[model samples]
Target: MTANASVFVEKLRSVVGDKGLVTDARARHPYLTDWRENYLGTALAVVRPATTEEVAAVVKVCAAEKVAIVPQGGNTGFMGGATPDESGREIVLSLARMSRILEVDTIGYSMTVEAGVVLKTIQEEAAAHDRLFPLSLAAEGSCTIGGNLSTNAGGVQVLHYGNARQLVLGLEVVTPAGDIWNGLRALKKDNTGYDLRDLYLGAEGTLGIITKAVLKLWPKAKDVATSWIAVPTPDAAVELLSGAHAASEDNVTSCELMSRQGIDLVLKHLPGAADPLTDRHDWYVLLEWSSTRARREAGNEGGLTEKMEGYLGEAMEKGLVLDAAIAQNEAQARAFWALRENHSEAQKREGPSLKHDISVAVSRIPSFMREGLAAMKKVLPEGRPVPFGHVGDGNLHFNCQAPAGWDKARFMKHGDAISRAVYDLVVSYGGSISAEHGIGRLKVDELAHYRSKIELDVMRTLKRALDPQNIMNPGKIVRV
Candidate 1:
């Protein structure tokens, strides 16, 4: 290490202590790479701050030294947002040591938590208080709430509870210059000046570090129903969902669309995974509906299950659904969900893949999927498409699995062309190229190219205004 880097490490160790500063190459391995293994970067050291005060102090030191800091929480991001650059000058600021649940306001329907608190822990804490924290995803077990808010994560529940932005009421942030902005107000109707909470929620830590958050919570579900159905086409899936909103009495919690190819991958690679339906179909829908009303024991209508059973029966009669499998118990419901949640892992095991997180108007999903598949084939004829996601919200993980036995190096050669075609199609449909994943280092060039000049200018202007030193997660989101 250089003399300046050695001095910087000592300064950081002074604030967080020797235990907090991980200088060993083996110890810093996990912090340097992303979850997907797409970005393996190098850092001067891995700094673990136990509290917001420590975070602010570390930021102050980095600011004074002009050394770049990569603020990471859980480091489960797909776009390489939390991963540091290859330059060994940057430091990886891990929030793992700061995990804590500060407060649970049952009456106020809000909970305050540290940024490093695992999302699952927060959910369990809220549930113990008879409240639901609806921000959920496949990575909930490992991903932290800070990373979720930083990326403004949207999961299966987005169709009901909205994204992480809507799930939080306030945040406590550490500014680029070490100033603490504690706006952790539990107010639902704050008409304050510029909404800084919204700015940092999806800024991907380019603007500031989210140390703590006041998250909105909802009543726990008393009755729930989950179903895996085989639909004729994407159009039919959309129609099925359009009717489900009312059939379930607006209790539709999630409506995920999966292609046959994706399902086949899960069944083949995932050991415990099984086909919910008998016959193979081109399209499938994993629909869930939950209501706060508890189901009474003695009644012909058991609960959401019976209601959904009737709804699916009608849908089948109308040719909207070809076949279906409704969960009989909670375990069965979880099994149904497991198939959806295990998609990422299954894809990883299958082979090299290109993930496109795009979204459009709900009504336009059918047409968009049709055109998107065609566009993918046009760009890379051999690319096996495995498109699936929250169809109810118009966000699809339009992924392209590599052909048969193609290696990563061989398959990634056509990634750029395929992505360009898919993005152009999404743009033509008035959809977003990035629906949930922020424009981290991976998509920085794409953001510059696809986004309007005015939008880019506004973003760049904000980055410079807040992080004048350009040390906070430098070379991420937008370069100042």
Candidate 2:
């Protein structure tokens, strides 16, 4: 290490101890890249602080040296938000060692936790307290709460509970200037001054580092019903969901849409993942309804399954559903959900792919897919389109896997053109090019191009005002 880097390392070690720092190249490799393997960066050192006070101390050292700090949590982000740059001058501030569950207020329906705590752990803890923390995604086993708040992640349950931002009540953040902002209040309504908690929630750690959070919770579901249905088209799936709200009495927890192509990939790659139905169809929907009340009887009177069956029968009569299967038990329900959750892993194993997390108005998803797929095929005729996601909330992972037997270098040649076409179509439909994933150097150019000038100006102004030195995750959402 250079003399300056040696000095910085010593100061960081003094604050977090020798065991908390990782300087060896091999030990630091995983933290240098994102989950998608799209970015392999370099860092001077990876600092693992075990406490909020230690985190502030490390930030103080970086702020004094004018060195950039890349705040990372679990490094599970798809947009490369937590990865450092190739310049080997930046220090990676990893929060893996700081995981702790501080409090669980069952009566108040809130959970207070450190930033490094895994999401699944939080869910389990809430369940132990007879409560529920509903923010869930595929990577919940490994993804951290800090990163979830940083990206404002959206999962299947967004159809009912909303996004990560809505699930959080307050946050505790460490500013770029090495100061702590303690706003971790479990208040249901805080009408004080500005909502500083929001400013740090979706900033992707560019504005500040999230150290802790006060998350909202709800009562656990006592009775649940899940279904796997074959829909003839995207429009049919939408119509089915529209009719389900009234039928399910607003208990629809999740409603995911998938193409037959995506389901085939899941069956091919994911072990133990079986197709729920025997007959293959062009489109399918994974519908789930959860209720806080227990079942009144074994059959029809007030059972969740009976209500779901009734809805499916009505939908079939209207041609909205071609075929359907309601899960007989929890195991069957999980088996059905495995098909939807394993989509990304299966796609990765298949080949190089272009994944776009775009969104449009709920009614315009069908038209968007029609034009977007055509535009993509016009560019790469042999591309394999795997379009699926939380269609109930209007977000679709409109991804395209590389053609069969095509290498990464070869398939990526058509990536730019395909992405441009899809993004253009999304813009025309008055939709977002990015729904949950932030810019995070992946879509920086697209964000600049698609977002209005005034909007970009306001974001840049906030970034500059809060993180004036540009030491907090530089070259992320903005180019300030």
Candidate 3:
């Protein structure tokens, strides 16, 4: 270990006590690696703080020692945001022990939760109070609120609820200099200057470490209608989405588009999972609508179901929808959701792949897909272009899997070439390279390359203004 690391470890252990400090290699293994196992790291020591105050104190010690510290929360990120570098010089400051739901103000329609609180737990707690925390993700069970905020996670609900940035009302963050900023207010209106909360929301622990957050909540939906539909192409899926939007604007909570190859991958990997439709189609859409009013108040009195049926009827007549299956009950709804949610997992099982989280205008999604697929196919070997995700929000996971019997190493060897082709097309189409996940270490170079000179300079200015020493999550989001 470096002399600086030894000094930092000593100081960290003193602040958090021996019980909270992990020095053993095995104990620190989990924190040293990321969720996807693509980026493994080595830390001087993993320090677990049980409270926000303890986190501040730990940061203070690391700051005093001039040691770089990476704030980690559940380490469930996809882009290596929480993983450290190979130097083994930085300390992993973990907030897992600070797990607490500070308050749930049902009347105020908000919940104050510590960064360590698991996303799924907060959802359940909100449900217990008959409210809904709409920031949902597949990793909700293991991912922490801090990671979600850092990444500005947009799961299947971005259509109705917006991303994590929109859901957050306030945040309490510990700056890189070890000072705490308590901005955890549930107020909807706080135009007190520049939006500091936003800078940290998707900063990926570069500017500060999020300690607590106040998140917006919605009235629990009492009635939901979910349908899995097969479409001829991405264009048809986009048309179907337009139909749903015309039918129910804000009530159409989710509209996900999946390709045929994506469905086949899921079926090949996951057990007991079947194709939703009888005939194979190039694309599919999972659309859903929810109502705050109960079924008796909605279907019987408000004509909610009739409106949905009418919309589907018109869509079918237009030939936008090839085949559709509306979920008969909650069980069937979950089954349909399972097929959509398991896309990432199934893709992982396929083998080494080049993943791209991209977004375009909702109307131009089909064009982006056609152009992006052609571009990727040109550079890549006989690979599979599995583009699927929240078409309602225009965010697509345009990932590439190798062809059958293809060598994983050979496919991954051209990962950079594949990424360049896709990202270049995305930029040409007025799209964002990252739709949900932030520019963590995985996309640091991409940020530097794609970001304009002025924008990159401003980001650097902010990083230097907030963290001059370059201690907090170095080589992430923006580097010093």
**lDDT of each candidate versus the true structure:** 0.92, 0.91, 0.87
TM-score quality measure for candidate 2: 0.98
Q: List the residue pairs that clash in candidate 2.
A: none
* Candidate 3 least-lDDT 10 residues: 297-306
- State how far residue 206 of model 3 sits from its true place (Å): 0.5
Candidate 1 per-residue C-alpha lDDT over 264-323 given as tens digits, one digit per residue, 9 for 90 to 100:
888888888888877888999999999888887556258899999999999999999999
Of the candidates numbered 2 and 3, which has the greater TM-score value?
Answer: 2
Q: All candidates' TM-scores?
A: 0.98, 0.98, 0.97
TM-score result, candidate 3: 0.97
The runs of at least 3 residues in candidate 3 whose Cα sits more than 4 Å from the true structure, single-residue gaps closed, are 2-4, 298-306
Candidate 3 per-residue lDDT, tens place, 378-410, comes to 887488999899999999999998877776777
lDDT of 2 at 235: 95
- How far out, in Å, is residue 85 in model 3? 0.3
